[model samples]
Target: MLLPPCLPQQCGKDFRNSLKQPSPNYPYGYKTKKPRIVPAFTIQSMQKNTIVQPPPKCNIYEPQPARPTMFRKSYKRGEFPVTIEFTLSGKRLSWKVPIEKLDFHHYLPMFFDGLAEGNYPYSFIVEEGINDLVKKGSYKVLACVPQIVIPIKRALETKRPAVICHALKCIQMIVTGCDKVGEALVPYYRQILPTLNLFKDRNRNIGAGIDHTSSRGENVADLIEDTLQILERYGGPDAFINIKYMIPTYESCVLN
Candidate 1:
């Protein structure tokens, strides 16, 4: 029953042949399963279901302070009052006050533009205790306009150039009293009547060449009368006379 060595060689070829033949249990070799794929529509639906919320506003309910209301009840620069007014319920307010030793040329327009726009809750430091209210702060309901400016360009243009210049000189003397001469400012008023009358006489002498034509004579008179009205309001001949004396001898022609 024992096989020979040649018989074992034959057995090895048969074993190799069995491996090459397909078996019923695994007919198509080892099978590989495919992975399941997610759909694009499902991903988009998830994104659509998500929600986001924004931050709340800081000041929505506060009411504005009443307008033209007096504040602190003290005079500024020794002449003007400090007053304030509100607009937009509780949203904004404005302040009217004067500055001392401060030129309007530098501060006015900047102060005015801010008022025209709603940029309050701000501040400007004038003195140690006083802040102009438009300073550094967060958005809030109680917005304050710490400054107000009145425009006077029209008033300036309507006045005669010479009269305007003269008024400034007179007002300076009346306000400051810087110059003291013999009879000081007194002789200045006495001088005014003569100078104005002189102007009239010169107009008559010039006749047709005078500023007033025959047809416009009444109108010219009205203009002069209006000027006189303003003069009376602004301290009259007394102030004018004082200003005349204050003029240096070298600049005397300006008074005329």
Candidate 2:
């Protein structure tokens, strides 16, 4: 009980007909879609399921409380035997006992602690005292290096651009004092480097295209680069590697 063979004209038509879908049998192989039944819910019911989100918290960099420096406390308490005299050069600390004869472990680190003070006299004394120490501290600086690091770390943690910039300058001062000073700082890279890395790309918000304030230490990014370069130069071979470990983004200043 076979049907008649398809002729050339009928073959095309029959083949096309065979290719047609045999589903819900809608035209163009489309199925007959069921009517959409949206859930029956009142506006109140819809509102019940809706979520109420709170406003986002502000993430702006608010100024932190200025940490009290032990140096300032001690100086005010008359512990330091230095008299502050205001000269044309600003402020100078004249030690009752010469700075060189003083205990490096105690007073050197004490002055370093004063670097956190943004106020006058204290700030001036810290800078002048540090310059004097760096110039005359001699081998005592290397010994006092470990003690000085804490103050440096504290200053950096303040996250104030000016304080951080000042701390970076202080870092360069100690690093330039001795070749071993840089290498000695290698172990403390973990402590000192985190803030540097945080501010590594940070530049001052200057609108002027030609930067008139292109001075060093003023720019955190430049200071960071220069500081690292100094570390690499004086830190021996292990310097760059340790610095790289702390700051993954740092490119070698010595290497091309």
Highest TM-score model number: 2
lDDT, residue 14, candidate 2 = 76
Tell me how far the alpha carbon of residue 215 in candidate 1 is from the true structure, in angstroms, after superposition.
Answer: 14
Question: Using alpha carbons, what is the TM-score of model 2?
Answer: 0.74
Off by over 4 Å in 1: 1-99, 102-187, 201-224, 233-256
Task: TM-score each candidate.
Answer: 0.17, 0.74
**lDDT tens readout by residue for model 1, 19-40:** 5555556658545454344344
Question: How well is each residue in 94-199 modelled by candidate 2, as lDDT tens digits?
Answer: 7788767888899888988987887777877788778777887667888888898899888878877777777788788888975478888999999999988887
Native-to-model Cα distance after best TM-score fit, residue 210 in candidate 1, in Å: 12
Instruction: Count clashes in each candidate, considering only residues at least 3 apart in sequence or on different chains.
Output: 12, 0
- Model 1 residue 187 lDDT score: 31
In candidate 2, the residue pairs with backbone N, CA or C atoms under 3 Å apart (3 or more residues apart, or in different chains) clash, namely none
Q: Which candidate number would show the highest lDDT if scored against the true structure?
A: 2
